[model samples]
Target: MGVVADRVVSILLANGVMGMRLWFGQVRWVYRQRRVWVLPAVIVLGAVALSWLVPYLDRRWAEELTRLPTGEFAGTFDASVMATVLSAVASGTIAFSGFVFSVVLLVIQFGTGTLSARMAPRLTQDWVVGAALGTFMATFVYTLLVSLRLGARVEDYQPVLSSLLAIGLALASVALFFTLLTRVINFLRLVKVLESVSRAGARRAAEVHPYPLGSQGDTDVDLGPPDRVVRHAGRAGVLLGFDEEVIAELAARAGCVVVAVPAIGDFVLPGAPLFEIHGGTSLAERRLRRHVVFGIERVVDADPAFALRVMVDIAIKALSPAVNDPTTAVQALDHIGALLLNLSGRELGITHIRDRAGAVRLIHRCSDWTDYLSLGVDEIRYYGRDSIQVIRRLRALYLDLLRSCPSERLAPVRDRIAAVDDDSAAFSTAFDRAVATSPDWQGLGGPAPIDDRQC
Candidate 1:
């Protein structure tokens, strides 16, 4: 009974408004592209449409509208009062919202100087900020129409209730206006932004790969030569995410394993191999691309690497000569290490997709521990070689990772440590080299004896 009830609830939820929002391609595009005006425009349009209905609704509920206590709730809202409030809401909302929006954009622009401009999409697409704008617009439109209902004659359809509602809504808009500024301040802090991105990646990683790390994997799935290649058109953007369930269904219908070529954050080029369809007899590239979504820039859609990418951005910026902040680089390493640790225990790839009858229909291989570690480590080490703070922190990070990860994952870390040692030899003074070369977690100037021992 419980299982059946659960299934019923799941079906209901899937058909709900939120479910429709999640599944719609165009809605997802608005979110990914950060079309800041789209949602608010819809709100404004809806408010205008609703305004037209207010008179009819008020007439239908004339008894309820007239009997409602207007004492203190409407505060002597005459035609002048109504006009004053509506005008303030309409004009003040536009002016204040414009100022806040400009400030936020400026903050994002300044942030791009330190972080990557690629991150700008994130702030622009924020739902809270967008909704704030929408709320102001909605309030303005509603109040304007309600104000029009106020008349000089006592019985000329005053719309007392609608006017009061409008005034209350205007007050609410003022509150939302202040909240938008708060959001702007919080969004300005780069560390906060990076942390949010990392957490988003973690949440997505958890959802997509439910199995624990080093867990059982598909035993025998043929991920051999592809029967056909699905190339992308000339549109370039960050691959945000795809509807995995929908893709699985399409693949099931076609009887093939469609493996995505580039990871989520990769800049997909024109004529690039987007998918390799194994055992696909007559799959159209257009049909397959429909399941994928590419935005203006990378977002934490499903890829775990995006978090690491942001961390690397911070670390690289810190290592740069313009902003010599090794401490910030070290800070990034901590979060990167945590994200890796999260992945270390979870399964990495989708090796097989099965139907209801447990028939294997798809095979894919996502990048494993080695690729992610290299992304987090390689360039920073190359760029920050001269900084003792960076090299030492990396040495400690690797030493800790070496002890924690499975034996096979140790090779890349070990190799990188050796490379760091060589870099230290070529670049470092004797004292700093001694400090960096030490095998311990913090580069304590001791022998790195773990290389000989079991990983």
Candidate 2:
């Protein structure tokens, strides 16, 4: 019977050690990978180490006491001394308990299984719950050990100390763990809902024909006055016209590609035109009111870099000799546009134009062009100030290219491709002024002519 009891104790001890090792190993691995959990985990691990060290130090002190003459100083390290020492130790353990609680909470955050496994698309809230449970279990075991140490003391006050420590650690561990896990669950659920709604809205918009602009089947490109008269079948009601070009430019500035084809504000109802394409020559006759194109007229007044970059991108894709990847260029232009907009204190009304404009205007204003129509001609004419720096830099680059290339050495074909001549005279003039006036342009080679061609 004694042998069986001994075997059972050994098994329990081994299990305890294994559990602790597993918990610490998993937690340390998680702490290393999860950027958010690093600070909290370090605090918890440090506390655990201190808790373990405190006991060892206490045992050493007790050994030294044993070596001294027993009765001579029997009460010297008296109840008061023990109380003070124990009180300090208790306080330290309590602080350490708080760290344990925090670790549990954070562990719950990463969820169960390996980090990679937890991140798998198939994994769900269950994994998070499992990790939280594991943390709670670890805390509980530590509390039990603390309780046992206090209970074994012969001093009458020790049991009370153990009970208090156990209760405090258990309650704190549970509270902290749930609070953090609940927060994680709520945040993730909110994100999921938003994602679902967004996907649904996009799908619905795609299914519908693009928002209609006019009675004639032809799409309107004029993005100016939303109330601008759109004539399709020679009959014209003020169908809302979004300047596709302007919106496209804004989209480009926002680092958004594809512009959603029918786009956000397209009126897809019957008798309305389909989505209009930007930079296509197809709309030249019917597309432009004057030399001014019908698509986003508001863009004409926006940051010129955004507008010019948009134009350059479009030109490259449609008509340039070579097409460079436009995504990076588009992002840079958008950042520039955003900076200019911010500096001006103008809302630019882009966020409104993109998403919640309907809530703001409430009626027929679906897009910026419609907003222009609803807001009246006065609002439509307001253009944000241009970034002169970007314009000068662009002009300077164009001029330097021209100066480096000898027109005489060029085949007439390459020269023509460069689009040099009296027509491009502004290129050299702009470059020279930029180099002279702008400190940024100093190191660049002297001003040269540039073709500014698609090539």
Candidate 3:
């Protein structure tokens, strides 16, 4: 009765988990990619069908085993005991196999078929090792329990174990053979034309280069800013992006035309070169040097009035300790309010100081950042969580400048202004410099160029 109850409980629990997963997936149908529900629905239904079949199979196996006569043992193979043992072994084996299959399927589906793709190779390696150890431990425990229950020594069960081993080996051999044959055929099919096609595509993409808008590049005679150029056609690529900000910054620094204005939030797309640096060989060699750093350029869609209110709050904070000039702060706030009145019914885009002497702040609508964010892409390419450090450093720099330096210092003002630039160049440069000594910096975007003409 205990064993029967356990089996029923396991079946019910498994079915319940599966049903919940299906329910969650259905709830997210509007947000997720279309038709993702069909396969999972089929899989859940199949699991439900198998749950019903399990008991029937257990009963049939029990009857078959009971029919066999026992010569040495006094007790017969009772249907309940036999069914319980069989069910335990079958369920354990099936569940383990299902887990393995699901993992392999997910890896193949998401993995680029390379070791680097899917879950990290290091994680997958750990999982395989853990599974092997677990399998050995489980098998040893099961063998010990069965030996104790049947009142048999290990030697007595040697033949049964040998038969099981032989069957396992035969099945493994067949599977290996088929796997090898399939791989060989796939290789042969691809080897015929893959190289030529790959080379041709590469050549074609390299040949396509579209020019830019007027005065986008650095015009400084000594050291110019990057030339702006458009890297891809139509804004379609931002919809599938990993990080549009990185691309946008890269494009701005590269002085490339940004053709496709992404919506509010979106993902980066494949085949979209981050940016097309127009100077070609000259820029390509120093591509790592021409970076434009923009710190967290977050796009929040709220009422213009609310945004103006936030700016007012910031201006008050700026005047508190740093500036200590309530009159100037109040004056700036008044001007901002009056300017905002010009945007009562329509959308407005503006960047200004949050405080009388704080970081440069921009509050605008219809900027490139909003366009990209509207596409639903939130990934940051160059800047990351570490960007907080960059802002803090800039604030510190501002404090220092105020203490000893002149009020009209252009560099400090430029630094503050760059912090709020839609391009985010000044913030990026400072961030890259701060993190250069750390190992984690390797993951961030490259350093900013020495040129400041474009600013």
Best by lDDT: 1
The deviation in Å at residue 158 for candidate 1 is: 2.5
User: What is the C-alpha lDDT profile of model 2 across 246-279, one tens digit per residue?
Assistant: 3433434433321122322233433344332233
- For model 1, residues 142-181, the per-residue Cα lDDT tens digits are 8666556543323555455666566666777778778877
- State in Å the error of residue 289, model 1: 3.8
Candidate 3 lDDT, tens digit per residue, 42-109?
Answer: 43344344333433343455445334456522234333343344346545554654565465455444
The estimated TM-scores of all candidates read: 0.81, 0.21, 0.20
Question: Each model's C-alpha lDDT?
Answer: 0.68, 0.33, 0.31
Question: Which residue pairs show collisions in model 1?
Answer: 213-345, 213-346
Which candidate achieves the best TM-score against the true structure? 1
Which is the better candidate, 1 or 2, if ranked by lDDT? 1
- Candidate 2 is scored at a TM of 0.21
- The TM-score measured for candidate 1 stands at 0.81
